[model samples]
Target: MNNLDKVKKIVIEKPLKLDCGKTISNFPLAYETYGKLNEKKDNAILAFHALTGDQFVTGINPITNKNGWWSYLVGPDKPVDTNKFFVICANVIGGCIGSYGPNTIDPITKKKLATNFPVITINDMVNAQINLIDFFKIDKLFSVMGGSMGGMQVLQFVANFPNRTKTAIPIACTASHSAQNIALNELGRQAIMADVNWNKGDYLNSECSPDKGLSVARMAAHITYLSKKGLQEKFGRKLQERDDLKFSFDADFQIESYLRHQGSVFVDRFDANSYLYITRAMDYFDLVKQYNGNLSNAFKESKAKFFIISFTSDWLYPTSENKEIVIALNAAGANVGFIEINSDKGHDSFLLDVPEFLKSIKNFLDANYKIL
Candidate 1:
């Protein structure tokens, strides 16, 4: 938080009316960029971040001292090949990493917005980031891509601004949030609220934080990111530095320790309130309903080419959901391609080092860019 001002950002002078009927103005939208935008500016690619992911897509994240979440893909000579394309990523409006969110202080009140922050939707997030496009004076983006919640934003972006991008890649995401996923998110939310320290999402001014509850939430959600096969192969019933169980409540298996470590580290870099607001936005996403049950209508106006990708083992979004988008694109007569990469890594496969998956993206972007 002390280094927040150090993050690159722009203050949007235009008022943004959120889906919850609240209007926000003069808010900061933090972002990070890679490579350079050529004279034509057609080399620009907008990359969206998933849940809990900030704008740091590649290289070292100065805030956490860890590798950026997408370091494996979006770098010089990598799949995205920032050397050839200028990649732009922004912290979604409901995000905590220097973006306007619950942790952001109200300039008027001089207090953290906290629970007073109005709920935002995926549509609102895309609308807020569009200001960045205008700020840079890019007439049309070369590409827009993301996975999971990031993918949802890609869909929303195209729907809102059909002529803004040349290509769209929505990987491992759905047009609408499924009931099961909503329930899973609710489970995480309950864990946070159960912590007395949460204090109804107004704990910013307090000394104690709801770290225990947040850690448990992360542990539970992390399981969904992996496949049963992947988990078995990686951890199995392996004991954690012991020949036998400790016979107590402490972590006895390697898997337990792994989950605890993930949860603990996540709490350090993330704000609990941001997690709550972002998940709620994901749940409220329903592109089909927005178009009156015809998902095809969502993209009917977009001439941009689309490429949807999915993993074989991703049960969270699953191949079915990704295919649905392809099907809708087909119905709309939009130029679209679909691929299901074989992987045991589950929903997080897109974020990992999967050669075939990376290669496909490179081929798509490179081939498309050449045509331009």
Candidate 2:
């Protein structure tokens, strides 16, 4: 974050009225790009990142010093094949990294926005990124793709700007946040607020953070990203570097240790307030409601090709939910494809090295790119 200025970004001089009834201008949308935009600029792909993801989609993230969140799928000769197409990814508004959010100091106030930042929605996030397209002077994008929260943006993008992209891939996402998911997100938000150090989202003013609460929230959310079967096979009742269980409350099971590690690392790179805000945005997402309860109507005007994908083990956003999108697209008479990949990796399957899933994406993009 100290080197945020090094990241690529564009300051939108045009005013963007957020769904929360607030207007903002001269805001930054931090982004990163890979490969080259061809002469026609038709080979560019706009990739949206999920919750906790940043502009780094592939290669080593300069901030985290780790591989990009979608490294497996976006590098040269990989599924997204950056070698053949230019890829652009941005840190969404209401996100912590470089983008305008709770951690960003308000230029006028000279203080962190914290809880004062306007509550943003998925629609607002997509609209902010549209500035990037205009900045690049791109007439249209070759493709738009993402998974989980990112996938949600993909659907919202195509629906909002039907003619802006040639193809759209929304993997392991839903048109509306299910009650169950909303509850899970609430649990995470509550965990953050419960921390005494949170101090009503003013922790930064006191030179402290709700790291403990944020860690617990991450641990809980990480479980939903993995399948039950995957957990059993990978961790199960295996002890963590011991022959017998500790008699105390310390992590005894390997699964417990894994989750704890996940939580700990997450708190280091992510902001608690950003987590709260983004989850709220996800819960408020209801494309169906926006279209008057007719999910098909959301895409009725979109001519972009859509490919919906789901994982066999993803109970978070199950095949059934994904099928709903496909069904809506079909009812709208849109050109769309659907695939329920066989994987034990749950909702995180799209981020992992699932050969079948990777192959499908490669084939879809390659075939479609040839058409262009």
lDDT of 1 by residue, 68-153 (tens): 99988999999999889999999999899999999988778988999999999999999999999999999999999999999999
List the RMSD of every prediction in angstroms. 0.7, 0.8
lDDT of 2 by residue, 1-372 (tens): 567779888888999999989999988899999999999999999999998899999999998899999988998988888889999999999998888889889778888999999999999999999999989999899999999999999999999999899999999999999999999999999999999999899897786899999999999999999999999999889999989977998998989999999999998899999999999999999999999999999998988999899999999999999999999999999999999999999889999999999999999999998885
TM-scores, one per candidate = 0.99, 0.99
Off by over 4 Å in 2: none
Worst 10 residues of 2 by lDDT: 1-10
lDDT of 2: 0.93
- Candidate 1 — what's its lDDT? 0.95
